[model samples]
Structure formats: structure tokens, C-alpha cells
Target: ARRHALRDGVAIVPAAMPSQANVVSLRMPLALYGIAGIDEIHDSVIEAQAISKGDGIKGRAHHVVDSQGASRIGRYGWKADIATLKDMVANAFANELGIT
Candidate 1:
């Protein structure tokens, strides 16, 4: 993919999710990482803020629900309450490659 992007004269930037290991390194409790199901999405939003707070990352971290006011979290891939920018990029890739 890098080669194809280079050959096509396109700029490529890969966004990375903060790994479980990294999240753990922030010194949050184990239970924090265990929150995963859709019901825990709101909890994850709070967790993000707490983790970022622990890590001293500035700015707020909160879930932005869609027009329907639903917090989806990990439902469609990626973390947070809704489809992230990375989700959109990956969906575009899937569409282009007809992956599903």
C-alpha cells in the first residue's frame, strides 16, 4: 500500500490507535480496559478523559453522538462513541477494494 501510494504520487498518513499496552502504561486500572461492549461506550468516553487526564494530555475527550444522539463506541470499529476519522478512511478503502 505504501508503494502504491508512492507510485501514485499520493501522500499517505497512517493513524494509529493507542494500544492496550499503551493504555495500560498510562496506569489506569485493569477494569478500565475491560470496558468494551456497546453499553460501555459511554463509560469508555469517561475512560478516555480519565486516561488522557492521567497521561496529562491537554484538551477534553468526549463522545460526540450523531443526530440521533446515540453513543456507539466500538460498534463500527475504532474506539470512541462514533465512527472515527480512521473508520471513514478504512471504509473508503474497503469500498474501493470491494472488501464488503
Candidate 2:
């Protein structure tokens, strides 16, 4: 079951240097922040807006819940799915390293 789960969890995404790499690695560390800090950063980021007739693109902060059940802005992952640095680290350990 664990092996199957790991196999399914692996994702293959396109890269700029296709010949050099196959999978994107979690090489960088996410900055740690308190609940208030996360909220502050989230508020500072530009809110998501609808595309206008001539608008190009707009990005919005993804909202997520922390391990403690508090709401927070997702600051990790490509889709902003992970809520906090601690969560991200734990996820990496469990999924990538099978440490859990």
C-alpha cells in the first residue's frame, strides 16, 4: 500500500531545461511564519481579480488551513496547497522520504 501510494504521489511536470531534468525537486526551503505573519503576507498580496478585456494575468493567494486548524494562506507548492513550512516539511518527509 505504501509503495502504491508513493508511486501515485510522484508527479511529472514540464521543465524549462527538459534534457537536464525529469521531475521537479523540492530543493528550496519555505520560510517559516506565525499565523499573524501568514495572514499579513496574504493580505499584502494582490487579491485575485477577474480577467478584463485586455488583462493579461492575475495571481491570487490560496487560502488553506494549518495543522492546528487555523486558516492560513498557502505559501508553498506549485498550487499553493501546503499551508505552512512545518506542514510542507512533514509532507516531504512522509511522501518523498517515507519517514512517517
Best by TM-score: 2
- Model 1's C-alpha root-mean-square deviation from the true structure amounts to 14.8
RMSD of each: 14.8, 12.8
Model 1 residue 21 CA deviation (Å) reads: 43
What's the lDDT for all of these models? 0.48, 0.67
Q: In angstroms, give how far residue 71 of model 2 lies from its true place.
A: 1.3
Candidate 2 lDDT over residue span 13-98, tens digit each = 75567676676666665445454354345434424342233667656667788889987768766898888767877888998779
Steric clash pairs (candidate 1): 73-81
lDDT string, candidate 1, 1-100, tens digits: 3356466877767778767535323434224233334443454665565554565575434455543455533334334434444454456468644676
Cα RMSD of predicted structure 2: 12.8
